[model samples]
Target: MSAETRVVLRRAAASDAAAAADVWLRSFAAALPTVVRPRSDDEVRDHIRDVVVPLRETWVAEVADRGGMGGIVGLMVLDGDLLSQLYLAPEWRGRGIGDRFVALAKRRSPRGLTLWTFQVNKPAHRFYERHGFVAVEFTDGSANEEREPDVRYVWQP
Candidate 1:
């Protein structure tokens, strides 16, 4: 699935907050073997305030080479060495966009990279494995445990 696809990876600005949230909810909800709350118009705005706004850096992935105005296919939040909330639109999956975003996150966090995924998201677990992340821990107490347990993975290189 790797075609040397060119995607614009750049620091997300305050102006792009809404679009980024849109893509996040869309992709988050569409991922397989997991359940995400369906974000309403209000919820989307609330997420931007509660989640995205707090990240150290929110990076946006766009197909446009110059990073011009367009849809955000994927995004990643860098919290020190931890790469939290990496998501890509379902339509963009398998296109290597998520892989590129992961690479960007790792580069941004050279100390290491860690993230969590629903234990049931086998495809995402495999994707992380392919990127050198190994599961280090698991938790069955997440509020969403009714859907699936959660596993934490880390890559230290």
Candidate 2:
């Protein structure tokens, strides 16, 4: 799909867990090649469905295809003021969906929002920076599941 394609962002439903999990896995694989992902695909899928979807305030972005069917292309998860996850399909990156997701998070949490990204994910750093997030802390990879160095970014309105 083109950058101009209309993307509908809404609260994620239980039925959307699978598609959102797919986006999450694909985005992680494409964006964080250097980080070690320890979870098997099935494990990640189950976590998304059982843990993330049920516990987090999640949103999904859906795009209408030419065939008139809508497909989930991206998703964001917020836990309190923490932007825990934001992922878009590989074909949907650089199309302002990420920006929209960040905007939604900011709107929902007017006080502030914070997130962590692997230090090796330079593209994510740039994306977050462009959206007004500033790096507040850096870690030596001990705190996260992947055991990769990470940077924490915060945005305050």
Candidate 3:
């Protein structure tokens, strides 16, 4: 299937919790190998299902493959001015889905937005920078669950 034909972005619903969690688990496993203490699949799944999906403004990207079966492949969670989470399935990276999700967050908070990403996630740092976010702070990894060094990026209109 063409890339354009494969993905759909939408506001996440309660029914999407499981699929969203699946994307979260898969993406986290594939992307965050340097995390000092990564959560188990079950634990991540539970948090996505119970806490993130219900409590955050979440968006999901659904992908339909050649066989026409489709499932959630990406997710973004925004909390107030913070872009708290953004992840895409391994196959979905390099597409513009993440940019679209970030644009949505910017639209929702046009004045400004901020996000924290692990310093080791160079791809994410580049992505945010490409979207006009500037690195504003660097943290020594003490405050996060993974205890990985991190950077904060901010976007202002």
Candidate 4:
């Protein structure tokens, strides 16, 4: 669908876990070619199905269709004051979906918000920066599963 298509952002349901995880996997692959994922595809899917959707504050941005909510174009997971994850379909990037996700995350954690992203993901850095997130800490990746250098960003009102 084009950027003009109607998009709906809402809390994710059990059935949305699969599509939301797919969006994560695809976005990670397309946007992070240099970094290696710590988990296999099946592992990620299982985690999303068994843990993220059921336990985390997960949301999905889907296209609105005549039939109903269309395919999921974006996924977001907010944990308390942490914006744990926000990913969009590769083709769906630049369509303002990510912007909407960030706005929602901010509203969810109006006090403050924190998130992490790999240092190699420059686009992500720019996006978060544009959303008022400041890189407050940098890690050598030792503390993370991927062992890739990362930056910790924080946003406050």
C-alpha RMSD of each candidate structure in angstroms: 3.5, 1.5, 1.7, 1.5
For candidate 3, which ten residues in a row score worst on lDDT? 1-10
Which pairs in model 1 have colliding backbones? none
Provide the lDDT at 52 for model 2.
87
Error at 58, model 3, angstroms: 0.7
| Regions more than 4 Å wrong, model 4 | 1-4, 67-69
lDDT per residue as tens, model 4, 51-116 = 999999999998987656479989999989999999999999998999999999988899999999
Tens-digit lDDT track for model 3 on 1-157? Answer: 3754678788899899988988887787788876755677788778888888888999999887777788898999999999999999988898789988988999999999999999999989999999999999999999898888999999999
Q: What is the lDDT of residue 40 in candidate 3?
A: 75
TM-score ranking of the models: 4, 2, 3, 1
In model 4, state the lDDT of residue 37.
90
lDDT of 1 by residue, 111-151 (tens): 78888888778888999999999999988835552445788
Candidate 2 per-residue lDDT over residues 28-145, each given as its tens digit: 9998877778999999999989988888999999997566777899999999999999999999998889999999999999999999998999999999999999999999989888
Where does model 2 exceed 4 Å of error? 1-4
Least well predicted 10-residue stretch by lDDT in candidate 1: 63-72
TM-score of each: 0.81, 0.95, 0.92, 0.95
For model 1 the TM-score comes to: 0.81
Clashes of each: 0, 0, 0, 0
Ten residues in a row with the worst lDDT in model 4? 1-10
The model with the greater TM-score, 1 or 4, is 4
Model 4 Cα RMSD, 1 decimal: 1.5
